[model samples]
Target: MYSPTPSDWREANRKRWDERVPLHLASDYYDLEAFRSGKDPLRDFELAEVGDVTGRSLLHLQCHIGLDTLSWCRHGASRVVGLDFSEPAVDAARDLAAELGLTADQASFVAADVYDAADAVPDTSYDIVYTGVGALCWLPDIQRWAETVAALVAPGGFLYLAEFHPLADILDDETGSRIEYDYFARDAWIEETPGGYADTTTPTVHNRKVEWQHPVGEVITALASAGLRVDFLHEHDTTLFERFGSLELRDGAYQFPVDRPRIPLMYSLKASRAVA
Candidate 1:
């Protein structure tokens, strides 16, 4: 199992993510050039589910490089703010926004630890709080993260998240062959062979990345505990990114196999605060 409980684990993860921001931007996965040409990287599922944001105040958490944040402004959001712990990423995002002629007020970027994002940005000021794929695993504790989300969202506002389900995290994918990890949260960390999904040549400095698993039930319960009511929870059998190592991309989305027991690959949840 992974070491470091919620406390120090989060700090370490934040630092690691900060270091990875630059690498990710240059990687093919992000495709910054395509994003700059006004191309939207968001999937149709999210685009449809999130609906319109015209004139709404939106806050994007862990908005690595602000691609989606800019997309929000392009879609008619009056104000959009992006928060990330990575300084390099935030700088690039700010520069990119300016390069695109987006006014400073229309979109802004902040670099801060995720847990402290609410303190760095406006409190109770956002109409929508948005988070996306591969976000939750980096977080060690969902409860504290929920509190930060609740703090930033205004009354009647909602928090929207589309993330890879925790269940997918457990399986083994050594040969892109079979399911491996436990379905339930058991170990704090699982020691894996060296290699990241993006880069397989270089050995990771900290080969082990600590993670926590939160079942759909635990996720809903945690969010509700933070004073946000669960509006809907939808689980899909497909994912946006390549997961389980050998998954193939088809029809603009990644898929496993239909023959195997359909495991929940992704989930989206909307929660709202009680009007005061």
Candidate 2:
């Protein structure tokens, strides 16, 4: 039986993310140089799903290092704010924004827990609330998360969530075909992962951490209960990372082998708040 206090788990994860900031900044996977040279950090799925943030005020929650948040500004968002629990990540984002010459009015970064975002951020509502890949699994409570998301959305605005499918998490990535873990949300997963997806070779001090899994149904239901109407849910066979051994890189994304069974690796949902 593995059970840890929420504060303990959050601290462990924050330390891990803090260590990852430097590695991710230098890793080819993130391509900091490309981002510095004016390349978009956002993926194609989000670009199509979120559909143009030009002059919109966007909020990115659980934003690690704020690559996607900065990208929103590059796409012409008038206001972009990123919130992450990791201090190092937030600092790096702020430095990068300054280096890129983004004014304070254009972008800002805050160090705060997702659950405490209402206190950390000034605006109670935003035109768009965007949360990207690998963000949800870190949150233990999806219902509370959805409530925060709903509170952040301006009237008539929408929340866009692009996350790795829970099904993908159950698959045995080492074997790449069978399910090894529980598909449904259960107890917290406590483990010692010294390496991260970005750079596995680099050793990390904050190795022990906790993660939670939320099924697709749970995610949708949480949002709906939070007063947001689900507009659309789209699942994709391709993913941003080669999460399984059987997956192959195709056009910058990972796809299952031609002969293998196709499964949903990622999903994006758009939920809207009605005007007051």
Candidate 3:
């Protein structure tokens, strides 16, 4: 495993993500063939929560490979921009956008870190600012992230975030039957795994990476402090992936077995900046 200084974290993460772009594009989990055939990866809850993007401009932060970003375009977003730190991912998104017959005015991808998004993207603000699941854990500073997210939302617009619940991070990864990690710990959690989440058997070289655990209260408070009002915070018993071995796919979502007690495995929120 690689133990990197704070300054090295972004570079390390970028390398790992960049290397995985091709792997993820080819992975059966992503199923690019199906995607090209008009498969939408945006979860049902995301569609309901971010209702009616028609004629709206959207900016998707940490938008890996831009699947969800373009999906929004498919739903009638007037324009969409997808941003990511990995250049490879950005390139893949642009190619996919072209293949989908979307013009630059309809969909664009930018290669930039999330913290620099305010200056990196084409617009000063968007009708909607969206972040998808598994994005927050990669960020080290929740306050900075909240502030960035807030800045990207246009007046009268809102930010929609869906992520795996931090509570799930505390439990053992194998069975998730016991608490094996500290939810409040601020130190960076570094791990080196052999394969990407999209395909566990695939060989990957840049496996070492850093992650953080931001509690639910901390996230909500940070957003509020950033001048965004919390419209709602809804916790769910289902998650997008098999976060734990104990979870099983049910109705297109991963959850514990029917016989097992339920827990909040994921959460979604809407926070808006008051109309100026």
lDDT of 2 by residue, 30-99 (tens): 9988889989878888898898889899999998888899999999899999999999999999999999
Write model 3 residue lDDT over 1-276, tens digit each, in one string: 223346788888888998899999999889999999999999998899989999999999999999999999999999999999999999999999999999999999999999999999999999999999999989889999999999989999999999999999999989888998788888888888777779888788898788888999999999999999999999999988888998999898899999999999999999998999
Candidate 2 ranges beyond 4 A from true positions: 1-7
**Which candidate number would show the highest TM-score if scored against the true structure?**
3
Q: List per-prediction Cα lDDT, in the order shown.
A: 0.79, 0.90, 0.92
**Number of clashes found in candidate 1:** 5
Q: Which consecutive 10 residues in model 3 have the weakest lDDT in total?
A: 1-10
**Greater-TM-score candidate between 1 and 2:** 2
Candidate 3 total steric clashes:
0
What ordering of candidates by TM-score runs from best to worst? 3, 2, 1
* lDDT tens digits, residue span 87-136, model 1: 88899899889989988789999988788987787544699999988777
Supply the global lDDT for candidate 3.
0.92
> Model 1 misses residue 88 by how many Å?
1.6
lDDT of 1: 0.79
TM-score of each: 0.89, 0.97, 0.97
